[model samples]
Target: MIKRYTELADAVEHLLLEKNSEFICYLQPVTSREAALQWLAQYRQQYSDANHVCWAYIIGNTRQPQTQAFSDDGEPSGTAGKPMLHVLTERELGNCLAVVVRYFGGVKLGAGGLVRAYSNAVSQAAGNAELRMISPSVQLSISVSFAFEARLRQLLQQYQAALDDVAYRDNVSMQVSVPQDAEPALREQLINETAGAAVIRQVASHSGV
Candidate 1:
């Protein structure tokens, strides 16, 4: 599954503001549904005086799932939460929490206007903040004779594998991070380049940041 690439934030004026109605959007990084819920609680307390708190979250690294919650605090039901959640899920973002707090003015926006306002708030926040993608990666460790260390390093660089660590001795021990899909090709290239003189080990799988 594809992951979110960056976090962003933006703001827009409410289309039907009577007197100083304000909406504040908060975006944060979250790894699990529990974390997202905790964030929702915290923001609810932090903005206790606001009229409404609406939130949405996408969780999991791959095959992500989505959850959303909202309180009108007196506004019409079904007007605030669903639209905000829609924005998050539509973008296929994961491990993230988005909340919009509203302070109502004397004027009343119809159901349609409420949906537009809440959705617009989240869309603006997502658009302006920075985001990052999380991908699956694997680490490969290799030991090579000193004579072949330079060639190995060059080959790793050519493949754009991140050199995690290196140790120098009679043989060189190097750790490299490669995309999960590319691990087999990397292993073959290393074996061929060192002419079977190198011993390679699969270290561990990691989430690529």
Candidate 2:
């Protein structure tokens, strides 16, 4: 499991020129394949005159991404998009996309030159973008009687869990988000402190940016 990883804080771009060819690289934070594609469409529209719009993305966990895809557009196979993706994975960047727009400058760079151009386009530009750590998390719903409400709250605080929601009725129902790595210890503490009276149900898991 990816306990922590880096992701772009915001969109960034860099331009490189190699052998009279222009390569403009754009790096942005994206959560899913759909989001990456949507951005790709927008960039294509924005740079409609570009000769090529190559792109790559790694969504979700960096160590083991939930989704990853790339396109070389019209460039030679494995020359453009793959090299850009290599730079992203080498940096262990998750939930991000790198798109390169090229303008033909009437110069033909060989495959090796193309790869270096695309790779450097991203590697150099990424230094200008802000990045932050992401911690994967799990959300759980806990139900307990009023008698154990205070103890449950204390346990949640002890584990640095985020109290998402709470409701009072015949019993106290609370929704909380906890770091994935600490879920087991928190669960055990809840069971012990509430004397097994707390009912915990996993709601969903996500990355805590």
RMSD of each: 4.3, 2.0
Clash list (residue pairs), candidate 2: none
CA lDDT, candidate 1, residue 122: 74
Candidate 1 local lDDT, 149-203, one digit each (tens): 8888888877668899999887899999977767778789888977787898989
Per-residue lDDT of candidate 2, residues 59-107 (tens digit): 9766788889999999999998888888888887788999999999998
| lDDT of candidate 2 at residue 80, scale 0 to 100 | 89
Q: Per-residue error at 63 for model 2, in Å? A: 1.6
List ranges where model 1 is wrong by over 4 Å: 1-4, 7-21, 32-34, 60-78, 91-94, 106-110, 133-136, 168-171, 194-198
Model 2: residue 105 alpha-carbon error in angstroms: 2.6
Q: What TM-scores do the predictions have?
A: 0.71, 0.89
Q: How many backbone clashes does candidate 2 have?
A: 0
